[model samples]
Target: MGRTFIAQRGQTKSTNDRQFRRDRQTPEVRYSIENAVEIFIHAKEAEGLRKSTIKGYHDTVRYFRDWLSHDIGYIDEITSTLIRNYINYLKNDRLPYQGDEQREKTKKGLSVFTINIRLRNLKAIFRFLVDEGIINKNPTGNIPLVKDDEHEEVQGLADAEIDMILGSYDDKQFAQWRDKTLVLLLLDTGLRINEAMSLTVDNVGFQQNTLIVPSEIAKNRKHREIPISREISKRLRQLVDETEQYFGEGSRIFMNAYGDDFTADAFRKRLNRLKKKLDIPKLHPHMLRHTFARNYILNGGDVFTLQKILDHADIQTTRKYIQMDSEHLRQQHNKFSPVRRLFNRKGKRL
Candidate 1:
């Protein structure tokens, strides 16, 4: 069959639009750093980037301006030297809350990892400016990211601690069911709290035994499905039944008493109350995720599979679970090494 030329209008329109853009692409005026920051952020927002990401750009720009004492000029003035000084300043900046109410006591400065984050933000901004012809050189191209080892080891709940927390919930009542389901879902699926909380009744496919994470709620903006156990499916169905009865079929699975969708603040508040009631120190949403990852690693789940389960963009992020597993290996080696049998305490030549 020959090509059915249904409508060449879209192609013709796009060609004309590209030609117009090229004709009007000459931006000869140099934008002030402050003005360019807003332009770049607005551009990002226009491109449908996440609000959290755009907010980060705003925060970094505001911080960078404050660091400059509001004397920053045109975008062209941004140099490798200025960025280096900003990095040094970030290295030396301390927080008042790392201590007590004395206000005079300040703890050590931000960690290398945090400093690297700010530097990365700067890199993104300057790179954007360079692309737009608002700046001549990429001021951040030469600055190196901070080493990961500069931060403390990633922490997670132990297996016994997981048991303690899970056991703490009675699950006899509705509230208990909701709380336990929240915790366990995070553990089982490694779903971010926001992603889990965003679930509507329809998102939980009970028949298929899968929890569908829509792109809008997903961090990576890619839709994915999580396989659910029969028990989870049953609990989800029960929760859906109760929630729909209260707030109709359009109800969120994790709504508050007021029928409002659960927010991170609400989760934290509930977790804090639970912590105080149970007297457990370290219980939070992300720890449940870490626990999930650790458990997955120890139970012979590989990094690639865990990465897909966690919806991570890069496998390097998933590789941290290997380190957690290695820690367990070190403990096991110390406990049951057969080589220990040949060693004597008073070893001259046993």
Candidate 2:
């Protein structure tokens, strides 16, 4: 049976007859604990989160639910102290997948980014609880989120690195064709991994040379079209032909050789394998999307265009991609630097 939240009841004691017999109710049926998680999951789906994102939300909250059920009891008892303790538990605990060698290895905790994800999910859950009248106020309202220093360093990928990653893909290998296509789609369209994978044959307009990604498929459930580059178009046509040949007409543009839909875990594994072979660290699918925006901005693309391409709901959200490279910074310094061309190698005065 699927997990259900039963309101828990605390143990009770009652005095009986002249013998003074005490009646005790078992602790199991205390209060009717409404699994606050159901509300959170339903809310995200109602808002049209992508299938992958919905799954992610479900997983995060499911773990949280389990923790609350077993390690801690009573939803009302969830407090800031409990949340902090839960964070520490997640940080210190060894994952089930840890091998013998890794078992003894002093593994580090979740990165600030990952920690923030758990925090965000919990916060969303509490917000939903409040909206549903499960709780009068959010306990996580004032809790400070873990600050991520890595985000400052990982502004975006560099232009040269982008070229290297794309160039690393072997065009002639059929086995890696779909894999390469995934990278191409992310780089060219700036689509999230889930959005790119959800695309069916008809979603692409060969005549218009555009791909129509609908709202429900996107991260934020916003529809947008991204133009395909000439090179990407050629590869997509080949991939489309192969997909039709293998899976019949109107099939997905990319699929596993076994004709199954690509899973998120599989994609992560693929990228990790490729990263190991290429000697790169943290080569994630999002990095390709970031690479796209970074290179686009480097080559004269502006925030407006980037926002549309990246499908960001706000222009400010897109502005983060406008990070200038070292060369751009140097050029700006040479053009309008306060020091006026420091040494004046060309004898051009300010």
Candidate 3:
């Protein structure tokens, strides 16, 4: 199963070859970035990475393939200079991965965070190629990552803010009913926006007080039931009852104004309108998810349970949802400080 790969520039066969078994016997395997990507992506699928993760690989590597002229350049043609050139392209040429009309950065090129995402993804693909003996060196070597500013983004809304948003919606109105249910479902269950929107009427178990997130729609590609609040369960049943009256019993739980199932883009636009109407500076499904995690931890739920509730593939991902800024820390201290618990007067013990 050995093949002769082209050598790196100015290097001998024995110099950087990890998989070269050819001593003038095996046929040389011509390797291009395009070929490597196709090979590697299949390997990724075989390795059981999530579909979304594989999609990210495809998205990021397409930029690399484009830069290298997929048909002409072999993997050995990748040099540090080519990688640097692509990094500059990401910074100066590509549109931001996620942006709004409000963000000025979207008008031109990507933000540092978005560029770093592509670079990190490139580094991963290069590492894979090197391990498989397709490339001798990782051209993405030692390139600095753009400093990401995710910490500065507000992680979760204040409890009072969440209350204000939820309470402002009047469920008698059809639009309010849908938005309120969407917000409450996200807050109570920690479901991702897509997962919640993809739910069919049968996916909800009114008697069991749970929502089934199917593996096909879940980010992790696994089926799990998210327990709903009694209030949410009641609201969900009511929505289903109303929708069933028109679309018959088995329609999607959340739908558009016209009572059709939601597409991802439609759901997002709906959330955008909800955010503006609520007067919340920022409101999105993930923020409600973070709010769920924060409140879960604050109210004595453990990280392991939070991990399962959030449907995170890793506990580390769940950990990011717990926001403990100075003000929050101070508030927690006022409630649970051991010194305050034991002392009655000044420094005197109770």
Candidate 4:
């Protein structure tokens, strides 16, 4: 073969080209906090986090970036002491975003709960950076969540309140009927407002008497079937049928007058109008969910079952519903007090 040269096993034209490129390429410059946040957001999106969750991450970081005079030098420049100073700023100096007129008018500084949420979001970002080897030290490692001193028992709507709210909606009107069904659905299922709103006709299972909260809409991103009562099933069926008939065969169960999806903001505005008309100031969507959880516990439903129904990741979160049902606990204690039962038995023997 006239002295044929053999190619090395590990060497190829492509490999040599890659090696040359690697040698000539400049090392990656340290990322600024702004750059890191953008990368972090993309990472979260790739991980399939909800838009709302990703927006929260962006908002929290944006506040920090603004606090640093919009020039967060580099990711590594973020330190525990700097984070503590930001916490102090959140506690004392940071005002509610001017975008929310209600919050701006009502609040001066961030609530402990709000501050803690921002801290947790920041911690998540830094933790992600550490895991990706973007930063060696996490600035939020030593930071503790702001302690909420005013933790109060969860308050759910009473029977009278729920009845009044339900009665306010006229079944004759499509919008009214839809809102009433939504309220009933929230109360019956303990579904988050967004989850309930995102539901479509396909999510309803009249034959099975269940509502399927798809993994995409669910906060925990777990697919779960919530059993529905006959009343709710009927209402859902009617809502679905009417929505299709009126809105021209859209998949969304709830629709605006223009046949578009009923957005959360629109629902809130409707609730605000209802609040004025019905004189129920606390009439909000989440309150219905709270009502469901508390009533479920009070009506002798187990915490374990309630946890699944509410899609709570932690049993501790479900236990709070039990703790909030203090009146129910007291009634049970009164009915089954061991000391009282013992005394009664002794008297009978005597």
lDDT of 3 by residue, 1-350 (tens): 44556757875555324433443323257686678888889999999888788999998877667666555577777788888887787777766543455644545567787788888888888888878877767888778787755556448888778788878888788867788888888888888888888898778888889888898888777898888988899988888888777667668887666768866677567667867887778876778888888888988999998899788888988888898667788999999888877774566755
Q: How large is the C-alpha RMSD of every model relative to the true structure?
A: 10.4, 10.2, 6.8, 8.1
Give the backbone clash total of model 1: 0
TM of each candidate vs. truth:
0.78, 0.74, 0.77, 0.82
What are the runs in model 3 whose C-alpha is more than 4 Å off? 1-32, 42-51, 65-72, 92-109, 130-137, 141-150, 325-327, 342-350
Q: What is the lDDT of every predicted structure here?
A: 0.78, 0.72, 0.79, 0.82
Return the candidate ranking by TM-score, descending. Answer: 4, 1, 3, 2
**Candidate 4 local lDDT, 201-281, one digit each (tens):** 788899899999999888888999999999899888888887788777756887887789998888888987888887875
**Poorly placed runs, candidate 1 (over 4 Å):** 1-28, 96-105, 148-152, 170-176, 272-281, 322-327, 330-350
lDDT leader = 4
User: How many residue-pair clashes does candidate 4 contain?
Assistant: 0
**Residue 52 lDDT (model 2):** 65
* lDDT string, candidate 1, 153-183, tens digits: 4667776677777788877776677888888
TM-score of 3: 0.77
- Candidate 2 residue lDDT tens string, 1-350: 23333456763543333333222222323222345566666777898666767787777766766666465555666887878877877676734334556444566565666777878877877777766666655778888787644454344555565666778777777657678778877888778887788888778887788999897676666788889887777778889898778878867777777777776568888888877987876688877777778778766777788888888888877877666668767876677775665655587655
Query: Candidate 3: deviation at residue 194, Å?
Result: 1.7
Model 2 TM: 0.74
Best of the candidates, TM-score = 4
Q: Give the Å shift of residue 185 in candidate 1.
A: 0.7
